[model samples]
Target: MTAHAPPPHAAPNAASERTERWWHRATGYQVYPRSFADSNGDGMGDIPGITSKLGHLSDLGIGFIWLSPVYASPMIDNGYDIADYRNIAPEFGTLDDMDHLIAEARERGIGIVMDLVVNHSSSLHHWFQAARASRDCAQHDYYIWRDPAPDGGPPDDARAAFGGPAWTYCEEVGQYYFHFFSPAQPDLNWQNPALRAEIYDMMRWWLDRGIAGFRMDVISLIGKDVDARIYEEGPDLHPFLQEMHREVLAGRDVLTIGESWSVSIETGLLYCGRDRDELDMVFEFSHIREGWHPELGKFAPKPFDLVAFKRALFSWQDLTRDDGWHALFLSNHDLPRQVSFYADDRAHRRPAAKTLATVLHLLKGTPFVYQGEEIGMTNARFERIDQYRDLETLNHFEEQIAQGVSPEAFLAGANRNSRDHSRTPMQWNAAPHGGFTTGTPWIQANPNFGEVNVEQDMVHSESVFAHYRRLIALRKESDLVTFGHTVQLMQDDPDIIAFERRLGDERLFVIANFTAQDRERELPQGLAGQADCLVWSHTPRGEIPRSLRLVPYESLAWKL
Candidate 1:
């Protein structure tokens, strides 16, 4: 099943148009290039590593692949602070290697989606260097630069997204520059039309290189606040996005997914509605933010709230059902493993993983699977703070410790929520370093990799990998699972998540018990004895009658 590529500028026909919308029901898998696979025995994953493992994704039954940033970078933010947009990082591979990987992935029925990080560039970037050389340079406006405050202090009191002040003073220019993240990353000046034209040209260059599309990073922040605030939202975002679409993506049969923060139903309509022409899909950061407190950061602990989670999920579903598209996901490169975060990784990892996958996949959106998620990977065990490599985690630990926080408590928080947990090498087998590499991996592998790995799980019928494969199969096989309208059932049951999908008499029910204890729920009207089970997290338990019993973390979907 090789991928079918549409002509570069083909005339619109019914079949071609339908094919253009193929991403609506597609299952996308995200591969963090540095952790996916290491083909060169250099302890770091690269484009060749991903190309060598294309068969694994094909075997897992994914339609598209999303590769995290491999662009030329100083690795200050692990490639997010890109130094060059058009070139591949030396650690990842060369331009030829990237082109080869794209071609190989297409041959295996996998469309490649590169990570686009245009919000900021590495301080080492030529443009940033030129901007910092002198304020009178032509490229001075390429990045956001401002004069110091009245009393010869820092610029406006905006805080960085990671922590601390957003402005960094430069002695050479005698001014301050704003960076939403690290000082090594300076935000681009999207208000400059010349910079916008340069970005559009770069996108066209990639599209012409036979790559499919992009997963834009912090794209919402591209629209700056008129008052120079550091917030994620702005008023002029739509116009910029619209112009981008018209200039670069008007006729290309490609997908553009944005990491949009502070999203609402109104924002969804403006960003992803069929008529908006801004983006194909946007990832709203509501449910993923459930475990963190408003004042406390990700390092701080907050008990998971089931009601809040459900409310956010349903709100997005209802909002997008009519006019917009969503990019559904649980775990990504930035967060801990979903099963470990949401379920008991020690007791019921398999069933919990399956339940999460079923609920997200059966919903009305495109599903995204982060690398190693298929095999129930747990969070990394970094007992000491020194074991962590993420800049955000390390800097946060230092900041909190300086502010009178205990090292013991801070390490505990970092162990629980650090991004390094998700950056561990992929568990290919039970060999040394989980068969991820013959040499030492850049980061440590999870100790549980011996039990939870691709080789062992791929052959096990009840493994999380097999369960995800079945769910993806159902999504491709059933129309109701793909395009049906969603309705919540048994909304008052806090332990049970039940939903109905209906598409012109093709009715389907998805019910799951999210806890480790068995739950029994009264069946809805017309559902009892009418269900023919299609997919289940556990073995079939006969027919779903008037009173249905769901095992621990069990999820089942049936056709009526």
Candidate 2:
């Protein structure tokens, strides 16, 4: 089936209207441009490649596409370390190519949301370049630059997320600069009103071109403490962000999804203000962080807190009830695939993914599906640490090696944990490089291609791909899946993740076995009236009785 433009008069109810305005009432697929598709056969994925795959998105019932960072960059942070905010990278595509992609998407009733990486710029950015060129330059205040500590050493105890000092010493300016991520990605000086104005002007440029909005990267990091000696935050952060809202996003229909990682709900709501309306929605960091230990960095070493997760979710929902929207997501470009997290139960990839998909889609927040997630992608294995391309991975390898860490063990950890796990060439087919390129791919594709590609699953009715198609289709056709109030039942179940989505008389239960073992649980006491199974990864065959006994990894949706 091909896409035709959505009819202008396709009106929806009030609950859904609220959702539609937040995300255009659409399923958004997140694509990391470098690994999505390769049109030029240059081995690297690019915009023309993504343009070609628009049909795949259309077929999957996607309403909008969130393209992650095609901006001009040094690739230090995989395009997050932007050198130019206004131009597209030569490696990705040209301005005309992106324009055409936008037009074609609109023609297909789909919209575009590009990555908004305003928190920082690549150290090589023109602003940073000029700043480093001279201390007295007009752009010198564009970045956070400081001097040595009172004891005459590097700044106290501020750790770089990737493993070294967060501050990088600059011989040119004879000062230390703040960079929460890699040193190459210098933090922007949002404290400067002049710099904030310029960022908003750039935002206007994209909005004026009819682009829908932005998926802001590390937006919470836009504010940093200026006085704490090491890691202290001052009260001035709110005023600055409020001013940003007034200047950049106010009175516009454009959606703003900020990455409020490391920010509290209080701060999150403040960033996504109600009265002033700073942001439309903000991504809560805790969703994708189920398995992480703070000391372990981004990767997970053990199971996460489900009860804690619920508290985090409900708190945000309550806090933003009358204010901004919430951007609910489980996986994205920066982490390992969901299969890696929930796939311990090898018997139920389809059911588990379907169940997780239901929970995210039916929440009050706007749902986001990462690239390759709909068809159920998993992590890949790497034999050597040197083969990793991610800057953080490389930094960790070097750090571990310096600390006398075992080389074999280091690569093993990197293989199971690196960001590259999600960046591998998307498995399009069983062909070489998983059909991503006729030439050598920029990165190796997962070896499970024969069993995982879209082509194979599209032809099989029982395949995971087909299940995702149905799930997304359900979201498109119903208000419950898009705007309903959510109540997670059996949240305490160690092996099952079950939740209910209700909009007045329309109620549905989404249950998935997170583990492999067949288990039984008494349905939560609150579920009343007759409830019939509506959708399941497997057919609603003889299995889903009134007191359903969910199979291993089986996912089912029941209507009450």
Q: Write model 2 residue lDDT over 1-560, tens digit each, in one string.
A: 01332433323445333334535356778988999999988888999999999999988888778889998998877899999998988989999999999888878778898898877899889999999888999799998878888875776668787879888888898888888888898888887879988998998888777787788787666666744743322366557667777887776666677776666765666666545456777777765565665665553245655566666666666665445667777778777777776464145666666666765666666778888787777788778665678888888778878878788867766655678988988888888888888888777888887787888867876676666677777777777776666776765666777777777778777776655667777766656445576677666743334465767667777777
For every candidate structure, what is the RMSD over all alpha carbons to the true structure, in angstroms? 2.8, 3.3
RMSD of 2: 3.3
**Each candidate's lDDT (Cα)?**
0.85, 0.74
Put down candidate 1 lDDT per residue, 369-401, tens digits, no spaces: 999999989998688887889999988887899
* Backbone N/Cα/C clashes per model: 0, 1
Report clash pairs, candidate 1: none
Error of 1 at 250 (Å): 0.4
- Scored by TM-score, the top model is 1
